[model samples]
Target: LNHPKLSLCPSLIMTIAFAVRWRDPELVGPARKTPRETKRLSDIEDQAGLRWHVPFVLFYRGRGGDAGADAGDPAAAVRRALGEALVPYYPLAGRLREVEGRKLVVDCTGEGVFVEADADVRLAEVEAAGLTPPFPCMDQLLFDVEGSGGVLNCPLLLVQVTRLRCGGFVFALRLNHTMCDAVGIVQFMSAVGELARGLPAPTVAPAWSRETLDARSPPRPSFPHHEYDPVPPTPFPPPGDMVMRTFTFSPADVAAIKKGLPVQRGGKKATTFEALAALIWRARTAALEIPAGEDARLVVAAGVRGVRDLGLPAGYYGNACACTCRRCPPPGPCGASR
Candidate 1:
């Protein structure tokens, strides 16, 4: 481990200590009949395609209460936990391959990439330096991704564990978006963490029942779902440079905002997310000076998990979110005009 102390300046160097293939153990065998094979992507998943991988990094200070556990080789412990976790999430271990030029499917190859790295800076130093508007860089924190064909040819999953100078660590993960959503990411990561802590299995076991999300026979729609309406092909404009800024809202700030929203006659209130989203939407539209005569819409996605009528099991990990479009005139106070 390189222990040269450094600050979190632009010149800080992060080195890859080692890179290795972390495939499933021979004892776990192959991903043959596990519900992970050739599993069809739901409409939501299909729409996402394989254009990007969801990458996330978690920073932990010190040994994180584990004490003497995995004292000498924490990365090895994480790799072992990941290997065991992959047995249940075998699809993540697989590769995505195009089926017939028109569709894509998981190849179920049972392979992944694991990397260990060393950062010369302490976690506190990095935090004090302040991350930028577009999120912090994962350059040394994650394995460098290579471009392959139109869709990335990288492994379905890539993980990097970087040790900090202050005995802290960062666990970074890159997951293909086609196979998992935000919910699935949480589910998979939780499983790995549990196993790393010497637990037998994840608190919530993953289920690969993609068939439940299939389109109905004859595809009858009980109600109009304008959210999925097809738009006429139009000339595409060049993409604009986008900036993402993370905002932290304190409990008091959230409470104040919630208090400003009107309560329904029945005393019902909008959720914190709904209230904040409305405020943001209005602010953006007003700032952009959108025409009042134009129609504006808020596209919201709601998860259908635990809905009694869906008949989905508790462990189902496939796409379960449905989108709804609420349209309004592009003017007035926050477009809440009924």
Candidate 2:
């Protein structure tokens, strides 16, 4: 990951200072009683590398009127919606336990963390500072409760809804990576939103047939799995000097980039993602001054939900993606081209 220096003016920097008063943490269970069952996670899901929490945040502008008046108590609404959503996605409310051979299983304990908070800033102020990646005071915004950060025998999902003084709220959550990937989490959150909006049930029912993705007995290796191979360590700048930035490209910018690329023999133009990824990879390689003799690689995660053979149901929210690596050798013509 490249960390370019952030150049912000003095006025913009002042917006970073804000205090969030967090309420006592509470455990929310399914609105209705869910079955008490233990289910083993797929081999891919419980891999040693996937035992961690992934944090995400979303900002919403305040509705007209005083805080909590027009919104009608967002914290309570979120809590209620999450409880109802947990009825089908109960595994998320369960705690992860390690059984024999270090395998992971959901204990179906029916408990998830929820925190209500209030920030002393307006939504407009936050947006003016730039509503992008590397958000300011992320720790306070998320608020990792004590004893809630463990990988095993801990809450699988932790949510904190911070209401801004202007009535807008920040929705943040930390989800266990072992349980699901980005797609899975998004599906679950969407369901919660639907229920909050008075939907009878989730548009797509949640499914938990993880055994379908389990490895076959006496695993057969069909192709090379180089992604899991150990990678040589590379030097990095000090953490203090590293800064993450988000870049936005308009549709015109994307069209311009695609126009510069060589046309395909079949007349199929490169996609926006393909063009941008290629452009960034080449620019990053050049900016880092990597040696011409060294190999540069880009790893992209491709979704496998569309694969009919996998038999992943409509709402199978497990890790159903594969990482493909593309290696570029030296700064050749392909890398130099627009």
Candidate 3:
């Protein structure tokens, strides 16, 4: 509605303008505030923002070994998992890419973002001793990588492990929020699991190409520089039964909100995304106690798929998103008809 010539515009503009909306925060995970380091989170942010791509790091807990007080040779188990994972690890295992004199590689060491410890140890003793890593899934070794500026530093996910009662290693794949959304992580992990088990993943990569997915030219930052305001930290690491949190909304509730809205007869139907986004914009403003006419933004994101689609190469890795925002202060309560 903001654009004067959107429909008549090229496919690129239509894709950029006609984003589906949802009340949920499509972009929930925030990058950790940049700690002093050689590599800055901003570099990743800028690179991803331009392309509308995000990164997702997954931690997997392997099957635990025989009864033992200490985790038995985790590095070896990790190596075996790597060997089994094969092609899924290909993107990471391949040679370094020197981009204008920078190296890009993977954590062949297997222990990424975690210190592999014996899961056999009793939790009662571990918790009573009070000497556990900040979390339980300690199988993922580390998250060190070279890019943008040597040593990418962000904890999209820090993996760890625990011994379940059934003796299966509870591999906790810590996910980095700044990289990709939960759904994206799930897709990637399922692919990895399929490969580890020697089965074909249930995915057909999307039709992707830089030419097809990238902006024809540089994208004119549609929304203002900043969209979501800095949210005060919430309960340490979102509470959940598993490693990540997933959500579902009732169809009736969604339809009720959509029914209240009026749209141009010729325009696209109001989607769940639009309804949710409009609701979030108002909620955030009200929660912060800003004036009724204040403005805010809502962002929706999707990852770019290359020729392979879901299994597309990593070069396509970057941000793909659009923001719904209040252009100027409103005279009454915040309204999308802005």
Q: Estimate each model's TM-score.
A: 0.80, 0.91, 0.46
- Displacement of residue 23 (Cα, Å) in model 2 is 1.0
Between prediction 2 and prediction 3, the one with superior TM-score is 2
The alpha-carbon lDDT assigned to residue 93 of candidate 3 equals 24
The prediction achieving the highest TM-score against the true structure is 2
- Model 1 ranges off by over 4 Å: 1-37, 49-51, 64-70, 131-133, 147-153, 230-243, 334-338
After aligning candidate 1 to the native by TM-score, how far in Å is the CA of 106 from where it should be? 1.0
RMSD of 3: 17.0
Report how far residue 322 has shifted in candidate 2, in Å.
Answer: 1.1
Candidate 1 C-alpha lDDT tens digits along 1-338: 12222224243223223222222222222223455456555655666433577778888887543323445566777888988888888877777766663455676767677766666666776666554334445555665544311243447777878776667778988777777767878888898899999898888988877777777876888988867766334333345743456788888988999899888659988888888888888776665566666655677878888688878787776668888777676676544433
Runs with alpha carbons beyond 4 Å of true place in candidate 3? 1-79, 83-159, 167-169, 174-187, 200-248, 259-269, 292-294, 302-338
CA-lDDT, candidates in order? 0.67, 0.84, 0.36
TM-score of candidate 1 on Cα atoms, chains taken together: 0.80
Q: On a 0 to 100 scale, what is the lDDT of residue 318 in model 3?
A: 23
Model 3 lDDT per residue over 1-338, tens place: 02111111112212211111111111111112211212111122334333222333223332454434354543334334433332332322221222342322222222223323333233333334432233322212222222211223332333333332223343445443333344445554555455445454335331112233333244565644544555343224334632532345699889988888777469767889878777666655555555434444455543334335434354333233334334435333444434
